[model samples]
Target: MLLTTVLIADFEKAGRATCQRLLQLEKKIKVVGEARCGLEAMTAAAKLKPRVLLLDPSGVEGEGVYLVSTILEKSPKTRIILLSERASDADILDALSQGALGYLAKPALASYLTKAVRAVAAGEAWVPRRMVGRLIDQLAPGQA
Candidate 1:
């Protein structure tokens, strides 16, 4: 079976471990690399070119949204999923606007994280169900 490569960019050991454990359950997903900070993430993204990037911006050097854009600039084909504990609606929308393909809350469930990785790698957007209405509202504005 073909494998979808994933790069994890998270500073916390616990966060990385959780992601790795969750993703490992899926036979089609393979973790190619990991980064502890923003610069490492940028370099890894360029070098590994993983199919999906799971990013937690709290440990990054610059702003989370900026890192997302920068990574996308370097590896345009790599899909990105933002994982955060304190992600507000505005923050999620901003990252999505900056080219993030997915967003998941920190401590993401295994099902959601794996599903998101697969969806994003397949060129689809992934966000929590609760955020769907808000996302639609943001994207369509008056229409929602």
Candidate 2:
């Protein structure tokens, strides 16, 4: 059964396109609402109580992680996926530290994003392959 409700929080034309693509995959993901900013994302989370929150790191406020934290607090069951154009290690870690379940780059394929959503919905964490080395370097500076 597809029980995942996806809420997208992005403030760009690409964001809207992403939403449209997700809508096309309606059977796999149910998009409950869309928000153009982190603050609005929080409000939507509270109201929709979606299973997945597809958040863009470059939203209205410069504090997307903080917004993720708020969403977690407001809706403990909601899983946050930080979607962004940049794949910096700092960005990925910060979002993970803030309780985000996954991170994906902007140009990421819709299938990849959908896979992340399914994994997150099933209580798994995801970090994109392109940023894996960067993430490893940050997590274990001397180990790699």
Best by TM-score: 1
lDDT of 2 by residue, 1-144 (tens): 766898888888678676658656658677878887767888899999999888886865666677778889988889998888785677788888889989887677465877888889999988976666766777789665
Give per-model TM-scores: 0.92, 0.84
Task: Specify the highest-lDDT model's number.
Answer: 1
Predict model 1's lDDT versus the native.
0.88
lDDT, residue 92, model 1:
83
Q: For model 2, what is the C-alpha lDDT against the true structure?
A: 0.80
Q: Candidate 1, residues 1-144: lDDT per residue as tens digits?
A: 569999999999888889998888888999999998889999999999999999998786557777899999999999999999878887888899899988988865565888888889998999877778888887788665
lDDT (Cα atoms) of all candidates against the true structure: 0.88, 0.80
Candidate 2 residue pairs in clash (backbone atoms < 3 Å)? none
- Error of model 2, residue 51, in angstroms: 0.3
